[model samples]
Structures are given as structure tokens and as C-alpha cells.
Target: MSLEVLAVDDSRTMRDMIRFALEPAGFTVHTAEDGVHGTEVLDAIDPDVIITDINMPRMDGFGFIDAVRDRGQYKATPILVLTTEAAPEMKMRARNAGATGWIVKPFDPVKLVKALQMVAG
Candidate 1:
């Protein structure tokens, strides 16, 4: 089955890259500009996985993860933090905020797809 993915990032290029990577891999992808927009998108789609960036104009990734977890239906859903920040403290913070996994920026398309499968499947 194809996985439905929601990618939340401030960069349009990143969102496009994610779509380019996932679409050919047989996944359905959705995107949002920031955490607040991501939440609005979430209300409209039942995605299997959520991928978000740490830095954004609106509600950053931690807040996004927290907001997602607040929704009962999405509490157990996998949320992956994709960011340029590789700091251990940041990773810990994301985990604490209810993220399921982490991926550094400039990610390999193959690895990204595999990680999504491992978590969402």
C-alpha cells in the first residue's frame, strides 16, 4: 500500500524535493509551509507519516509535534523531524516533543523513503 505523507517545511525547495523523492516511490505526499499550516493540512488529510523541519516562520517543529500529539487520533502516528540541526540536544528535544524519528537535512532520497516505510508501515 502507498503511504500518505505530510511534509511541513518553510522552504518550498525542500517540500518539492520531498515530493520528488516520494512520488516516484509510490507514496502520496502533501505539504505545508509551517507548523500552523501543517496543522491545518493535517485536519484535511489522514497521513501515515509526518515529516517536519525544525525552523519555520510560524510554529516550529517542536510545537508542531506537540500539537500533533495533542490530537488523540495522531498520538501514535509517526512524526519524523527533518532538519539541518544535528545537535544532540535538539534531537532529544524533538524526541521529548513526541517525534518518532529524526533525519538530518540534505537527506538521501532512498534513506528518507526507507525511514518513512519503517516508521509508517
Candidate 2:
């Protein structure tokens, strides 16, 4: 089955890249500009996985993860942090916020898809 994905990032290029990577792999992609917008998008789609950037206006990835976990239906949903930051502390923070995994920026499309399958499949 095709996995549905929601990608939240402030950079339009990043969102586009994610779409390009995932779509051809047979994954359905949805995008949001920031955490707040991500939350809004979440209300409309029942995605199997979510990929979000750490830096954004209105709300960041941590806040986005927290918000997603707050919803009962999405409490166990897999949230993956996809960002440029590779700091251990940041990864810990995302883990604490209920993220399923973390991926550094400029990710390999194959690895990204593998991670999603491992977490959400």
C-alpha cells in the first residue's frame, strides 16, 4: 500500500524536494509551510507519517510534534524530524516531544522512504 505523508517545512524548496522524492516512490505527499499550518493540514488528512523541519515561524517541529501527539487519533502516529540540525540535544528534544525518528537535511530519497516504511508501515 502507498503511504500517505505530510511534510512541514518553511522552505518551499524543501517541501518540493520531499514531494519529488516521495511521489515517484509511490507515496502520497502533502505539505505545510510551518508548524501551525502543519497542524491545520493534519486536521484534513490522515497521513501515515509526518516529516517536519525544526525551524519555522508560528511553531517549530517540537511544537508540531507535541501538537500532533495531543490529538488522540494521532497519538501513536509516526513523526519524523527532517532538519539541518544534527545536534544530539536537538534529537533528544525531538524524541522527548514524541517524534519517531530524525533525519538530517539533504537526505537520500531511498533512506527517507525506508525510514518511513520502518516507522509507519
Candidate 3:
């Protein structure tokens, strides 16, 4: 089966960028415009990996992860967070909330793909 990835961000540009990066690598990329929408998509698709931006409307990355983890289907899913915030505390919070890995923005496509490979593997 093809590996599926959920790319969550508010910006169309960011979401499209992530889709471009991951799709060429043989991944099926699904996108969520915001955390609220992400949850709805998650229920339907159940992507193998989730990469979300911290800042978003209608429920942020942390909220998304929290909601995902609460569900039986996604409890053990690997979640990678991408954010402009680089504070240690923010990282810690993400970790505490259940992120498997983290990346700071302005995102590097190569590194992101590598990270996706690592997580997907």
C-alpha cells in the first residue's frame, strides 16, 4: 500500500509546498487547511504520518495532535511538527503533547523529505 501523509497548515502555499515535497517521494499526500478540518480528514483517511504547523486557525497543531491521540486509531501514529517557533519550551510542549519529531521553519525540502522518510520507515 502507498504510504499516506497528512500535511496540516493554514497557508495554501505551505500546504502545497509540503505536498510537492512529499508526493514526488512516492507518498500519498493529504492536506488539512486547519486543525478542525484536519480532524475531519483524519477520521476518513487515517494517514500514516502527520506533519503540522504550530500556528493555525480553528485549532492549532497542538490541538490537532491532542485530538488525534485521543482517538484509538491514531494513538501510536507518528506526528512531526513544523513551526516557526524554535523555543525550547515550545518543543517541550509539543513533545509532551505527543509529537514524534520537530522541524523549524522556513522549511528545507530536503530535510523535510528526509525526516518523512525516517518517520515513514
Candidate 4:
């Protein structure tokens, strides 16, 4: 099945990487530079899942998750945190903000597709 994904991150390379990884897996990938941009993009598309980085300009992943959750339409959409930070506290914070899961950076493409499927499918 094809999944619609929104990936929010400040790094252009990271967005590209996510696109490369998911596109071949039959996923349609959308990208934004940061959380603020993510919300903007979200207005036009209904994503099956969202992936975000912790640190970003304007709004961070925590705020993004909270924002998405506050919108009733997206309250149950699975959000995955894709970031470099893997501290226990950080993961807890993401959970508190309503992230469905977390994946460390330098991710394996196959694993990411599997993860997206697990949550979004």
C-alpha cells in the first residue's frame, strides 16, 4: 500500500534522504524545512504519517507534535520523530507530545518504510 508522508526537518539533505528512501517503497513523500512549514504544508494534504526532527527553526518537533495533536483531525495520525537525539528524556518528551514512535538518524531505508507501514498502514 502507498502511504502519504510528511517529513519535517531543517536539513535539505535529510528531507532528500527521506524522499529517496520512501519514494521507491511506493510512498508519496512531502517535505518541509521546519515545523512551521510543516503545518503550512499540512493544510493542503492529509498525510498518513508524519516524521519530524527535534531541533528546528520557528517550532521544534515537540511543538509540532502538540500542534498536530491539538487539531482533532490529526489527533490520531501517527507521528514519528526522526532525529539525532536519542536520550531517554527526549524520547519521553516526544511521547508526551504525542509522537507515535522515534527513529534515530542515519536510518536504514528498509526499516523506515517498515516503520511507516507499521504505524500508518
For every model shown, the clashing-pair count is 0, 0, 0, 0
Q: Across residues 3-121, which tens digit of lDDT does each residue of candidate 1 receive?
A: 99999999999999999999999999999999999999999999999999999987999999999999999989999999999999999999999999999999999999999999988
- TM-score of model number 4: 0.98
True-structure lDDT of candidate 4:
0.96
lDDT of 4 by residue, 1-121 (tens): 7889999999999999999999999999999999899999999999999999999999999999998999999989999999999899999999988999999998999999999999998
lDDT of 2 by residue, 77-114 (tens): 99999999999999999999999999999999999988
Candidate 1, lDDT over the whole model:
0.96
Quote model 1's TM-score. Answer: 0.99
CA shift of 23, model 2, Å: 0.5
Evaluated at residue 83, the lDDT of candidate 1 is: 97
Question: Which stretches in model 4 have alpha-carbon errors above 4 Å?
Answer: none
* Residue 117, model 1, lDDT: 92
In candidate 3, list every pair of residues with a backbone clash. Answer: none
> Please, what are the lDDT tens digits per residue for candidate 3 over residues 1-121?
4689999999999899898887887889999999999999987897889999999999999999899899997888899998899999999999999999999988889899889888878
Q: How do all models score by TM-score?
A: 0.99, 0.98, 0.96, 0.98
- Give candidate 3's whole-model lDDT: 0.91
